[model samples]
Target chain A: MLGLNNRDTRFFLIVIALTLFTPFLLQPFPEGSAMAQFNAGYPDLMQRFAIYGIFAIGFNILLGLTGYLSFGHAAFLGVGSYSAVWMFKLLSLNVIPGIILAVIVSGIFALIIGYISLRRSGIYFSILTLAFAQMSFNLAYSVLTPITNGETGLQIRLNDPRILDGEGASQYTNLFGLDMSSSFKLAMGDYVFTFNAGYYFCAIIAIAAFYLSLRIFRSPFGLMLRAVKSNQHRMNYTGLNTRPYTLAAFVISGMYAGLAGGLLAAMDPLAGAERMQWTASGEVVLMTILGGTGTLMGPILGAGFIKYFENIFSKINDNILHAWFSALPDGLEGFLVTIIHPFVGKGWHLTLGLVFMLVVIFLPGGLVEGGQRIKTMFSRKKNSDAASDVKPAE
Target chain B: MDAILLQTLNGLDKGAAYALIALGLTLIFGTLGVVNFAHGALFMIGSFCAVTLQRLLSISYTTIDPEKTDFLGNPAKIETPYIEGWFGPEIGAAIIDWSVPLAIIFAIPIMVTLGFIMERGLIKHFYNRPHADQILVTFGLAIVLQEIIKYYFGANPIPTPAPTAFKGSLDIGVMIGFDPNAIIYPIWRLIYFVFSLIVIGGIFAFLRFTTFGMVVRAGMADRETVGLLGINIDKRFTIMFGIAAAVAGLAGVMYTPINSPNYEFGMEFLVLSFVVVVVGGMGSLPGAVMAGFLLGILGSFASMNEVKQIFPGIDQIIIYLVAIIILLVRPRGLMGRKGVMEE
Candidate 1:
């Protein structure tokens, strides 16, 4: 059972199954159909879902467990990416070496930042982390141009000294000899499903990351972290130095973020300073909150939900809206289109903002809690019904 | 000396803006004990108020006149502003030219109403929630407000120029016994600095002299004690929120000519203003203003060529660097009162 309880084992298995069958599950609509435009079974989109899922999962470890909301995680992500691309340029196009270096570099980076930032707690901690990230971003964009390649971003070039791969050994990133972008397409009846190598690779790593997080969440350290979140002052009063524990959690989460960033570079072989921006940090926070911050499966669900909306909902234009509403009366159709227009296509962020607001206002625990509430409500109704039946019989 | 003075002068207008926004942020934090992320959006909306008024004033009717023939020998078409038709042509043109200043009047009521609604409708429910929740909800509101503006304004910065009188630069070096043209500053920038000073002075005088301001200050010091004294401090807090919104909005209204109002300007300023608020201490008004100007002036100094030669890219991160150092060293900020957001 992988050191998990029965319920947790089942949950782990469910996640594995979902990750494995995402291609088929996401491609429910038949090929060439209007609904097929919403199908998110392609290689590019699937890879993003898994990668961002890893990112959100990593973010949740620090924020959810220790309640230390660091708004600078993207700095680690950007550092990891830059390290990875450097590996690709200097070492080889192979992903393993690049990814390993990425994790190490970002781990060290996180250790330094976390050491400084964890000195303060609460909103001050948040501000400190934000400042560090902003400084990193500013430096990367200006002074650190030699390493980061400045505004144009760091990318692989043809004539660079790729020591391991020699000269001109396939510019694309690979795992050994297998190209990451290669995919196997299957068609049956009117349905088409793509089995992408990059997605599966990301999925495997995401699963491992999730398992590691699960272990961390159930360990004695996790209990200590929760204690820290609930009452750090009390922990200090008990003569327990909570700084090391929080710092450890911060570093671990940073490594997870680095691993995600490495995978991203492995898929694309490029790094940009924009990845370190505050808004990028905010996106991960959004995913964590929208999914149910402290829950196990919430971040992944939130990541997928958001990525889906960003890709599919934003593709629906006025032409598609007109086609869909063609059967309705002219005035009513026009009214509905006008009403729905702002929430879709280019205005997807508007919908995202509104949904995030509503979630914070009403569903603070997010989608996972909403599901739990519904389940409890149904069970309670059943219990009451059983009680009424016994009374009637009596 | 002249170079230093020029940089200081250059920093003044920007410092004025930062002070105004941070002042409002401090006011809301002190009165309501809520971390409002949407305060920057109020500032943005204020700038847009000027843009909106300018657009409204330029609404025109077209007429064809046979007296002036076109190149193709057809009657020429003339477009005239509705204001010009209502009043004389000269008066209407002047009104259109002075739209940016006139927007102060237009933006005040709108910003105040928006602030009241934000407090009573949304923020009122979150009074007892955690700071994280307040930050998240307000951040969401900020995004929503900016996105709504983007939808209307099409994501471009609209140019709202100042009146013709203040369009030129002023050479103050001659009057100050320096060489001619040693210090030439923009007239509008100087005007902005004076206006911000007046606004800051007015806020201080109101807080020092007025009964409402005194009661609000007492509530900020001890809310439970004020409530126990049979005073409706919540109503006064709501009014304070409106006033804070107006302060931010007026700053935005005046700032239109300097940077041109854009949807993303809210977010850009929000991050800097948050840093300013933190460096000033969370709930201290004078601290906010002083820190705002200090950081602003420091930023300009860092951007100077001499400083950049010593440390490249320092200007971009000077405020954040200072904030980090201060937060680590002092923790309470420059003028922070005890027991206010210490946790």
Candidate 2:
């Protein structure tokens, strides 16, 4: 089906289905309910889910398959955002040109950085990429102010030289006549679902990117990357140009980050220097690792989990906690709240840090490994149960 | 000449900070083969030691003062420190004034203990893991430590003042036959430079002269070989980790007055320090110090008005620019021994 093998075809179908139904799936609670705050179906966040999903998929191609952990991916992301914003400033509010420019610019940047950084491998490689990213960040926040708009970041002004913003056309991003922010509000009983033009747009692109990544993962080039990771010495002895392969992966991933950045700007017309910061890069890495580095579904899962936590979960406050445990005895609830206070709400960072540590230490392969472990355990239990039942009275 | 000298002096203080942090980083890396992303947090904690002592000493009781009023039109509730109440105002005030210096004595043990706990509790398990995994775990630890500090002390930069005695700048240029104030440098900065020198010299001497240091050096060179000789290299490495932590702590303690100790200061310094480490070479101790000073000096020079005229914000990226150039030209770094981490 669709030129993919049976398994891949199934995977594609699953992803398509998920992306199509995301609005309904994400909006679990009814509007006006207390749990409405937890709904991630809003345009802004849903757009992020798709955008970051694309980003992670690209990242996995390099880090997961090639085993070249680029710590400066956020640099590419920032570059993409800057380029997209510039495109908006000069050309039009149309996202196509902006996104294309983002990919091309970031791809060039990745090519240059990757060529230099890939000279060394392991920790040295990580450091080199980090240095490059830091330099870029410093430049964006300070030196490149004319272009990047300094620490305040670049934002669209009312009088931008957008050549395509004809006489009475809208200043906002659009696809032909369809507004990016335009959404359909479906009212069914108590639940209200938002079908946003922007979210769907991003979702389609993310799915396409995901499909491309899947193809790349299954391609012969991917096998060579795995080979490079598993045994570089033998690969060298056998005489293969590992550099080009790694560099290609790096550029591809950088372009993915760029696309993600462009989509972000498409959703909200702004670009900040902080987007280039190492922390942003680290977040992407964490997303990839947390989801399951090498797997297709893992990166998307990880990105969603993190974005959800950062956006929705972090907003849970003392009031929410109190409400949650209100059914318990007053004294017990108060004690529980106090005990749990330090790891939630504003203390979400502590939880994030601790969770990161736990994931890295315990589940090195990430959440997917945990899932696999559970599945195997259940299967083993069932098998044992079958054996026992088949046996006589024992 | 004086302007150059002033810049050099400016560089020295920053150089001292970079050197101290990088030195500890090298020590830990050399001894344990683990890249500690949380080392800067140790330095931050060291600075916080000064803050902690300041808070501890300034534990106060409110008393109504009829002589003065606060912001509102009421009798000022003057708070007298416990130290002032216990020991007369003069000595207590002196103690409070010298809190940063006093923090050195307070921070060392705490830092060492923290180091020990960090190693035994967390990093010890990661010895055999891939470098990426190690970096991730340490990065996580850094975040946890940062958030914890932020939780206790808000995100603002807390200015931990130096002693009043060392507040003024020394007219070293006039003493060297230049105009007065032409080459004036902060006294505390000079002290910090001298302190760094002493610390660096002391560490070198300890490694050269002492038996434990010798054994540790031997272990760093070849741990299995030292273990084969039944030296218990693990214990020595743990002690080395403690020493490294104390070194970073001392640096942080001294740096509080220079740069107000903020929760994010660790992260801010970490990138530069890590760059210093890389530019110095992965496991080479002297290289770290050399790179730190070299980068620091270059950075100061780049920040000059003349340089900024040529290329704005050059100073901000000078260290990174130098690092990239160096990494490209010499992958092993200035004094990095070949094949340590060349692959």
Best by DockQ: 1
Reference-based TM-score of each model: 0.98, 0.97
List, residue by residue over A87-173, the lDDT tens digit for candidate 2.
Answer: 999988888999999999999999999999999898878888998999899998887899999988888887899998787777788
lDDT of 1 by residue, A77-137 (tens): 9999999999999999999999999899989999999999999888888888989999999
What is the C-alpha interface RMSD of model 2? 1.1
Q: What ranges in model 2 sit over 4 Å off?
A: A384-394, B65-76
Query: For residues B128-176, could you state the per-residue lDDT of candidate 2 as single tens digits?
Result: 9988888899999998999999889988999999999999889898898
Model 2 chain B TM at: 0.96
Compute the lDDT for candidate 1. 0.91
Q: iRMS value of model 1?
A: 0.9
Give the fraction of reference interface contacts each candidate recovers: 0.75, 0.84
- Please report the TM-score between candidate 1 and the true structure: 0.98
